[model samples]
Target chain A: AQTIHQWPVAEIKAVGSPLSLGCTIKGKSSPNLYWYWQATGGTLQQLFYSITVGQVESVVQLNLSASRPKDDQFILSTEKLLLSHSGFYLCAWSLTHSQNTLYFGAGTRLSVL
Target chain B: GDQVEQSPSALSLHEGTGSALRCNFTTTMRAVQWFQQNSRGSLINLFYLASGTKENGRLKSTFNSKESYSTLHIRDAQLEDSGTYFCAAINTGNYKYVFGAGTRLKVIA
Candidate 1:
């Protein structure tokens, strides 16, 4: 079975501080990875998606960036955190272009003070 | 442009009762996937339909590509079914999935 793991389940940071969240996929290689954000009582918004290493596409840019340094590792980072950036971040993976089903990670809750 | 729109933004049902959730797409979709976001905020994939209907236990889903719509029917609802339901569509041109706002369902015992 495949599993997606995300670190720092929850975080509270001050405005203007940097932010970094990590996600790792197990039991799958070269999977398509995605990053999503959901506000309090709101819908999920696609932030970024990567098809392979060193290639990431931004869907709804909020000045945030994504990186896939390894086959099963994806990272979401920002230099300056904003209050608007506070939300639930989710990492998902799909079986390349052959599969449309997305398996999501546990997610990280970030709150900017 | 909103590619996908889900009906019944919120719903409340009694245990054993049933209801249907619908999603309409503005463009032709290659496939549609239904998911349930639990209280803990983890999304569980319920059904992934490319063209036809599929059933599992008390949940069933149907996708019509020509009509550009999909439906999910929940029979004999239970308290554990309470959560937010989301429908995402895969676009043929790019294979990028666009998700709906979601339908919040609360089943009370």
Candidate 2:
């Protein structure tokens, strides 16, 4: 079975502080990975997606960035946090492209103060 | 523009009752997927339909690409079935997914 794991289940950070969130996929390799952010009771927005290591595509500009350091590891980070950046960050993976069903992680809940 | 429109943003049902959730697309799509997000915010993929219908236990889904619509039917609902249901489709043009705002369902016991 495949499993997606996200780190720092919940975090409260001060505005302007640096932030970093991580995700890892087990039991799958060479899968397309994506980053999604959802505000409380809002839509889920796609931030970035990567088809392979070291390459990422930005779908929406949210003052955040993502990196795939390993085949199974994806990282989301920002130099400074903003109140507007506070939300739930989800990591998802698919067999190939967007046409396939996405497998999402438990997600990281962020709150910027 | 709401490319993927879901009806009845909210719904409530008693245990053993049933209902259907619908999603209408503005254009054709390659495929559609249904998901359930519980109160803990855990999202679980329910069905991935390219066309036709599929069923599992008390849940069933159908996708009509020609009509640009899909329906999810929950039969004999239970309290555990209460959650926010989301429908996402892959655009035939780009394969990018458009998600519905979600239909929040509350199945009371």
| Number of the predicted model whose TM-score against the real structure is largest | 1
Pairs of colliding residues, candidate 2: none
RMSD of each: 0.9, 1.5
> What tens-digit string does per-residue lDDT give for candidate 1 at B1-109?
5489998999999999999999999999988999999999999999998899999999999999999999999999999999999999988855367899999999998
The fnat score for candidate 1 comes to 0.61
Model 1 bad stretches (over 4 Å): none
Question: Pairs clashing in candidate 1?
Answer: none
State the DockQ of every prediction. Answer: 0.74, 0.64
Candidate 2 residue-wise lDDT, B1-109, digit = tens = 4389997799999999999999999988889999999888888999999999999999999999999999999999999999899998877744357789899999998
Question: Per-residue alpha-carbon lDDT of model 1 for A1-113, expressed as tens digits?
Answer: 89899988999999999999999999987899999999989888889999899999998879899999999999999999999999999999988765578889999999999
lDDT of 2 at A107: 97
Q: Which consecutive 10 residues in model 2 chain A have the weakest lDDT in total? A: A94-103
Tens digits of per-residue lDDT for model 2, A1-113: 99899999999999999999999999998888999898998767788888899988888898999999998999999999999999999999988644578889999999999
Chain B, candidate 2: TM-score? 0.96
